[model samples]
Target: MWVFVAAVFALLYVPLFILAAFSLNDSIIVALPFRGFSFEWYSAALDDVDVREAVGNSLLVALAVVPLSVTVGTLAAFGLTRFRFRLKSAVAGLVGAPLVVSWLVMGVGALLLFSALSIPLSLKTIGAVHIMASFPLVTAIVSARLIRFDRSIEEAALDLGALPRTVLARIVLPQLIPSLVASALLVFAWSFNNFTLSFFTAGFETTFPIWVYSNVEHARALPIVNAVSTFVLGVQILLTFLVWYLLRLRPGGRSAAAPLLPGLATTERTDG
Candidate 1:
């Protein structure tokens, strides 16, 4: 098992290592036996106005998508997990359908939907599309957290004269904070990295991924693209470490910190 895991990790890291190495090369041409090592490409990436704008666009889209997606998804998770509803399983499958559907297909579908609504394709539209694409992941993460939660505490809150809204706000939402944070980070990452969805939804302007795609066809832009990729990888790594550190700060170490909603009766396993 350890060997298999090691092999899988190696497979993943090799390509990333190659990309990182190439980003440091002084030469503009990516293919080489060994170009002199320099941080010039990184500097070039910083100086390129197009790359900066693309990065900014990606950041803006993620900022818009993460909060909206997490809020909607968390609410949906609560409804699905806390109540017995008709067609629950079917609804869940529909929510998670994006994972199975090809991004290309979804992108095309999004373009059609936007066109029907008379919404002009643009960065804002791309952000909206990202919200739709990322919401399911938030729902799934929050729902997974909810499954192990007991419902009796919420019932007790009701018995104590708390209204349903009060119970949800005071009793349920607090416990789900970890999952909420995790979902936000995941959604942001997904939105930042997404290409095909952004491709269809983004009109004249480009996000980072779209910029990278355009650069792939141009010889001069290849090294700059690599530099942009390295920056993205760095940011992602930082966010990942931040999540890890926050989890570590929780009681009972990292594993115990998962998705326990605040004010929920975790020790007693109460109803959420």
Candidate 2:
């Protein structure tokens, strides 16, 4: 089983490895045959004003999308998990509906919607769509964490006369820090790498992925494209590792401090 999984992963990533390797090759043509290692492509990509601008645009969109998605998604997850209301299940489904939709379809739909509203294709529209695409995943991640959370902790704090804000700030937020950070990192990576929405929405402005797509059409620029792609891939892998590390650290595990609510950890405690 492990061998089969490893083979599948190799099949998936081998092309990326080739691309990264060729990015460092001195040859302009991306064909095989050993070429001397060179960092000229990376230097060229870094020096290109267009590449720098695209990267800046992507960074701006990610910066806008991550915080908005994480904040709203976390609140929505808490509401859906802890409260009951009319059409609650329907609302949850709506929140997650984008996950099943094709990005192409979503992009086209967003384009038409914006056109109808007389909104121009720009960074704001791109960032909004990215947020919509990412928040569903955030909701799913945070919801899973909230589902397994011990609600008794909140109730105990409330019973002990702790204000709701204090309980949330001191206890709930601490427990949720892992999920929140993981979700934020995942959303940032998603926004940074997003192509379809950015492609459709970016009018005069370009993002890194869109810029790569445009430049890759020119065969001469393939090496520089590959170099930039390798850089983006490395950053994404780092973010993925951070997410994994955050999730792997068990929340509220074996800490020296006492429980948030006094006596709540005792065996005689009865609140569920």
Candidate 3:
């Protein structure tokens, strides 16, 4: 079991280790041969104006996508979980269809829709597509937690003269903070790394992934892309640790945090 787990982790992270190593390679060509180490590519990536612009565009879209997708998804989750309607199951299926569908197919379909409506493609279109693609996951995450909630507590609160909106804002949403935070992180990463969907929907606005795609054809740009990717990976690692530490500080502590940072969380069983 340990060997299998080790192999799986190696498969997941070895490429990242190699990418980080190559980012320091002195040669522009991204191939093996143990080139002398240098940090020039990192500086080059920072100095490149196109790379900077693409980074800004990707960051802006991702930041925008997190809130929009989570808001839409959380609302959908509430509708599905808290309300009864004739089309509830059908609506749930429709919301979740994107999870099973191919991103390429969705992107192409979105392109056709935008073109038919004569809506010019831009970062807005990319963000719209990302929201459509990712909101279902948020719904799933929040719905699962909502289903497990103690309905009696909410009922008791309602009996105490709490407004419906107040219960939602002060009770339901507080309990679901971990789910919301996890969903936001996932949405941000998905939006930032997405290429195929963004490629189809983007007009003149270039994302970081798009910039890398366009520049990868040239040998000189490979190391720079590697450097940027390594930097991104480092940031993600730091953010993950930060989130875990903050979760540990929450009132419920690591037990509450286990939902999002399972690897860093611990649980104990007691019998009385």
Candidate 4:
């Protein structure tokens, strides 16, 4: 059993390790035992105008995607989890449909929708599609966290005369920080690395994934591609580490998931 697990992990990760290793190799062709280590490819990747522009565009779209997806997803999660509704089950199915649906189908559907609406494709369109693709994942994450939330704390806050929004802000949101941070990270990574949906919706705008795909067929670009991809992987790892450091284990050593509303969900009351 352990052997099978190890094999599965190796199948998933060994290629990534090799890719990272070759990105540092001082060889133009990505083969071989080893050339001396060099940062030449990394330098070249950073210096390329198209590569920089594509990366910049990807960052722009991902930045836009994170906030919007998180907001819409958090709201959707709250609605689904906190309310009694006629179509609650159906709504959940609709939200989760994107996760099960193939990117190709969604991409094609997005393209058709944009065309029917006569909306010209651009970076905004790309951002829109990314939000569409990513929010369900965000919703799923936040909903999972919310499901385990103790409602007594919330009811106490409300009974103490806290406004609904105040109960949400002070009583509910405080415990949801870790999940929100995780959802943001996932959304950013998803949008930045997206290709198929970006391809359908991007029109003339290029993102990092599109640039990498365009360059993939060229032998001359392989090492530089490796360098850029390695850099992206490092950034993702750093982001993950930073999030864990800041949220999972705080500087003061308290769990970020620890409830802030224990006895402090207080505000003055007014009778009307």
For candidate 1, which ten residues in a row score worst on lDDT? 263-272
Model 4 TM-score relative to the real fold: 0.87
lDDT of 1 at 224: 85
**Candidate 1 regions off by >4 Å?**
1-7, 257-272
**Best of the two (2, 3) by TM-score:** 2
For model 2, residues 169-210, the per-residue Cα lDDT tens digits are 998999888778877887787788888878888878899988
- Cα lDDT, all candidates: 0.80, 0.82, 0.84, 0.83
**TM-scores, one per candidate:** 0.86, 0.89, 0.88, 0.87
Best by lDDT: 3
Between prediction 3 and prediction 4, which has the larger lDDT?
Answer: 3
Rate residue 88 of model 1 by lDDT: 91
For 44-87, candidate 1 gives per-residue lDDT tens digits of 88999999999999999999999999988888887888788899
Model 2 TM-score is 0.89
lDDT (10s digit) by residue, model 3, range 1-272: 99999999999999999999999998978887977999999999999998899999999999999999999999998899988999888998899788777888888999999999999999999999989888887887778778878889889999999998999889888988877886777677778888889999999989988998898788777888999989988987776666577666767787866764542221101110
Candidate 2 vs candidate 3, lDDT winner: 3
Listed per candidate, the RMSD to the true structure in angstroms reads: 6.4, 8.6, 6.2, 8.8
Count: clashes, candidate 2: 0
The window of 10 residues in a row where model 2 has the poorest summed lDDT is 263-272
Q: Give the Å shift of residue 184 in candidate 1.
A: 0.3
